[model samples]
Target: MSTETSVTPSLDRAMCAELDAADPLASFRDRFALPEGVIYLDGNSLGALPKDTAAHVQRVITEEWGDGLIRSWNDAGWFAKPVALGDRLAPLIGAAPGEVVLGDSTSASLFQTAVAAVRLRPGRRVVVSERGNFPTDLYMLEAVQELLGGGEPLERRLIHDDGPTLDDVLDDDVAVVVLTHVDYRTGRMRDLAEVTRQVQAVGALMLWDLCHSVGAVPVDLNAAGADFAIGCTYKYLNGGPGAPSFIWVAERHHAAARPALTGWHGHARPFDFELGYAPAEGITRFRVGTPQLLSVAALEASLDIWSEVDLDAIREKSLRLTELFISLVDARLAPWGIGVASPRQSARRGSQVALRVDDGFAVMQALIERGVIGDFRAPDLMRFGFAPLYVSHTDVWDAVANLEDILSTEVWREARFARRGAVT
Candidate 1:
């Protein structure tokens, strides 16, 4: 495929209709419960809700919890949901069943895996990561360092490499290399296989934060030889907000890897109620605490819809949608000082396309008011995500049309739109 296969889009709705008609995934749009008149481009931030989620949550509350109470943990199979959900999600990222499990928040998962990686290589005293990584990652790493880094002189070296490759950073001193698979702000992608190989070659383990790469992009965790990985389900997975994050540890590290946050649930035999903690065999050990039952139930409902869907189709549609948005923005919005901050090449980018624009927060707020719901990142980036399962080509075309109208009329300059919200 061309680096950026551009689509002029004819500046017309008919073209979008034609594209939609040809889309194999078109019928899936009705499966979501998006608000009327809204073109949701924020799935990269929070996914659109699946139609079955509410009913499932109701059942969990009314039947499982209300009636069965504590017995529901066994009867309703609540205890096994994390592993089951992880199995369902495995193929999406090309991971095997026993390698992944869901629990805890993304930050917590990152902390566990990083600590374990450091412990595995006691002599190594440095953890190398990108300076541009999401703040939570750097914060979590710093937290890990303070707890573990003592007289031995440990360092959390944040590299500012302009390129994705860590040619200058990976070394024997580095116990583990932490990097996000896709950049959160700019939507740029890293070569996972290449990076993993390089890290391992230097005797350092590789841990990837797959938050932005899991659903929209295809990741072969085992194929890339990635030692460890962690990701959230709430984005393109369509899992509800605060849905548990998942962690994947290579089978080789299962016996050696010991997470710091050892809870009763992660214990090998919780029923035994032993005095000391013995981690459960396999991925079950990654369980942090009692599962967030209702949220996981909601996620199960979402995953049920995802069970039959092919990820290749999702990746294919994502590129098409983003390519359309980029082309439209380049052709129409450059004069407004709105330029693509993300990679122009589809292969080099994730599912979201970020635009560097003046007053990005205000512009995104304006777009939201106009019913185009993308989001703003700090320091001038407006990100729009394309989730193929529900978002149609017509939605993309209409969103672009709305943006063009708003830019041309200077609707973004309104004082109400300029006023910032706490969340943005």
Candidate 2:
């Protein structure tokens, strides 16, 4: 509970073994395809591959596509994957059946839902958000506003004070309040329940960008009274890169809420070729296009593994791993000018911890060279993500040891490491 800085002993293999023995999800680590001699701490960016994804994708490609051809869409159950996968993912995020649907990128889903929210609240012009939200969320909102420009152009109210409270901005004129449940840079979390209540107090809709918080933190969207939500599959879900994203609309919105992107797939009678667009009942109306079978299959494979594990357990282990990393790094690396940028309070933090150092990029490059794989953000933040399913406690200890060695020897000063890479 102490926010006051203090140091703990360096992480050791013995401590790791004890933690691993106590971990309920320890056996689940074998389900991933982690590289040998490397400690992966970038699950917040792209998750490590699930072992089943290869075979699942192969079956979809060879049998479903090669054999079944266009007929596979119906025979192989490809048409239902979006809603089916949503049902599978519902329990992890505390959403009920028929409330969530999968499709499109996170940005596209946000645009669709934001437009729907505006339509639901007539005559509202303002959309509340925070400045530090992920760039795509902000950009998508701007694009939507531009596309629908009348006197009702969407306006953004960015929060930018020390621990700024959003209560004041929840006015009657605000149509939607879009926010990232967990901050991408600082790993800070917002109280979803309280924020939803505040936004609804003035008859405004709450749209949560759950890209960072979905699998890493415990979220009860239904319990929190969340109106709409969207998130990607790649991060803590262990789905592969560029995986399709999901959108959830409360059941209350199903009958009345109108989808902005009214594609043929979402029409109630697609085969009838109706001239008018009558939206499909329930969450199926959120589907904007044909499902990506390969990506959805990969997500299914990963979610299969997740289905056997408890989300609450994942959250607990995530906190333990992050806390251990912070304690160890602060004790050993603080003398070299590393400052923890993430919130010290566990409740306010996500699965990742951000550390600030003068040469963060080069330091990360050195760590990568030494078999530890964390990422470097802009300016000076070194981001380390702890994936509870695949990352072991021993990996955390090894990563810290490599960091300590790099800082002690100043190996990051090498000219080769100082040069920026394409991906970083």
Candidate 3:
């Protein structure tokens, strides 16, 4: 934010330009509607707006909904979009066809999958999860435990993160284990297959909350033998705000796990108007209510962008971006009392990086004022995301360059910066 100051900078813009030129994913930056002179490094929290998404939603609004009216559900293929979009997104996470579907938010999907997972193992009374997991997950598990066991409650075992793996936590008493693949605060990643194996060894079902890992990193749900997973669309997926979330269940679990929300759409014969409710065949049974057409249209358009993208290229660029950011921070801001909170090793980290600093909320505010947008968490942590599709090497360089001046001049500690807002 204080880049145009008295201090002479060392990190040159020319070197950053050269790096962007050679980057294979450089051309894809034009796909998003990025503003002039802004470096959007917060894509891991909320993704940049896709260029094509607006037009796609408009077509659905004017032609499909406005013109077709009630018939659009069948005629315009609106009802089938959730499944189609799920099938399209399945390959991105290494999931097979007919195993994934779209609807609701990540919180609701977590509740749905978790409820069914616990029910499948009827005899087991313990539900295991981490205290450091996303807050909604822990809350949902608590609710699921109460609802499932009726008057007799199931125990929700919360394992604190003293070390990596839950050696003593995974036992025969556990019925379901919920975990977030990539941690939100530190960006620490867990080994999916190894954890899955441990959960299964004790005959417990594994449910992964992929909120931070889905599109920004590699997640092979099927290859790793994942039982269930749920993730959001507004972040790395580049869907618009409040985009519908996705749910994936292994083909084997469809018959055994029941849908928690028994709405009309999930009924086998909705039009038949039967007196009793019947679950739809296969994955369709997970569909709870009428499909969210507008949000689905925006997400479907975003998925179209993914069809041309190679995840390998995206991942490679992502690592480079994060590496560059971390190196720059260590070189320039280390002496200023800033500390890296994220995993140092490339293989063990997510697409985002976090830094520990005093007055982190104000520092982020100062950075945002300069158009280098990032986010801040509670206590003292500043987070920056590197979404490969749009962010370039030069953008990363410019962000650090601005940060260097901000820290050196103590610009972040200004009285105006102390002001807080609702969202931050």
Candidate 4:
């Protein structure tokens, strides 16, 4: 499949419609249950609902839960849903069947994997990560540091765009390096294989937080020789809100790796009710407790949609969509000082792009009001995600046209748009 379609960067809606018509993945858009009169570009934050999700959940509830009841754990395959779903999700990230398993949340999974990674190299005292990583990873690491630290907490070394690069901080003392595969705010992607080699060369394990990269980009944990990885399903995966996160441990680490959460579900003989904790063999060791089954059912439904699509095709459409958006923004919105915050290079970026503007929050609110739903990060970046399965080229054109009008009219300066929400 060609990642690039020959489309001219013209300020014409008809051209975009042509691109949409030619898009091989265009039919997949109908699989989603999107709202009418809404252009959803927020898949980086939360994915749009799959059309099959509600019916699938209803079936599970009525047939499995309502009818089967407790027997559903055995007959309905509830006990193995995490591992089963993990196997289904493996191909998207280039992982094997037994290497991935679902966990509670991205934060909990990070803490679980990070602790195991730190334990792997006992004497090493430092953990390296980016300063701009999603706050939850850093917050979870703080807890990991305190718990593992005998007298004093482990030293946390953070790399930044300004100074103290990864090469500067990496050394023999570093036990593990935890980094996001794609930056959430800026959408800057890292070379997974090269970074893994660099971290391992210093005798440190690489634990990738794939929260932004998993469904948005192609990831190969084994191919990169990465030690651990964790990601959420609600984003590009289109799982419902609060869906379970997943953890991937390299096959090499399965035997010796010891996660911090030693729930009975992860016990070697979970049904035996063993007094002492014994971690289950393989990825099952990562399971903490009884999973939120309804959420898992929702995720399982989403996975059906994923099973049909091709990752390379998704990547191709993703690049095209982002490229179009960037080109349009540069050509039309430049006079208003709107800047692309993400990497201009397609290879160095994920599926999303960030636009830098002074009044990003208010502008995003205005855009949301106009039915162009993207999101804002902190002080200035307006983040837009392009899920190739649903987001069309014409949608990109309409988004930019709407944005151009908003900036030109100064509608973003209204008092109502300025009223901040607790979530944003």
RMSD per model, one decimal = 1.4, 1.9, 4.2, 1.5
Assess every candidate by TM-score: 0.97, 0.96, 0.96, 0.98
Model 2: which residue pairs collide? none
**lDDT for model 3:** 0.86
Please say which candidate is ahead in lDDT: 3 or 4.
Answer: 4
Q: 217 in model 1: Cα distance from truth in Å? A: 0.9
Query: Per-residue CA lDDT of candidate 4, range 54-122, in tens?
Result: 999999999999999999999999999999999999988889999999999999999999999999999
Full-model lDDT for every candidate: 0.87, 0.87, 0.86, 0.92
**Least lDDT summed over 10 consecutive residues: which range in candidate 2?**
1-10
lDDT of 3 by residue, 1-424 (tens): 1111122236567877887999988888899999998999899888888899999899999999899999999999877888889999998888889889997989998888888898888888889889889899988888898998778878877777775347777788788999999888888888899989889999999999888987888789888898999999899998888999899999999887797887787788988999999998878888899878899999988998888888888888888788878878877888787998988877778889999988999888999999999999888989999999999878988899899889888899898998988887
Q: Model 1 clash pairs?
A: none
Q: Please state the error at residue 54 of candidate 3 in Å.
A: 0.9
Each candidate's clash count: 0, 0, 0, 0
Reference-based TM-score, model 2:
0.96
Worst 10 residues of 4 by lDDT: 1-10
Choose the strongest candidate by lDDT.
Answer: 4
**Tens digit per residue, CA lDDT, model 1, 248-329:** 9988889878887898888999989999999988888878889898889988998898887888888888898888888888
lDDT tens readout by residue for model 2, 292-391: 7788989999999878888888888888888888888877787887899998888888889999989899999999988888898899999999989988
Best-fitting candidate, measured by TM-score?
A: 4
Q: Report the poorest 10 consecutive residues by lDDT, candidate 3.
A: 1-10
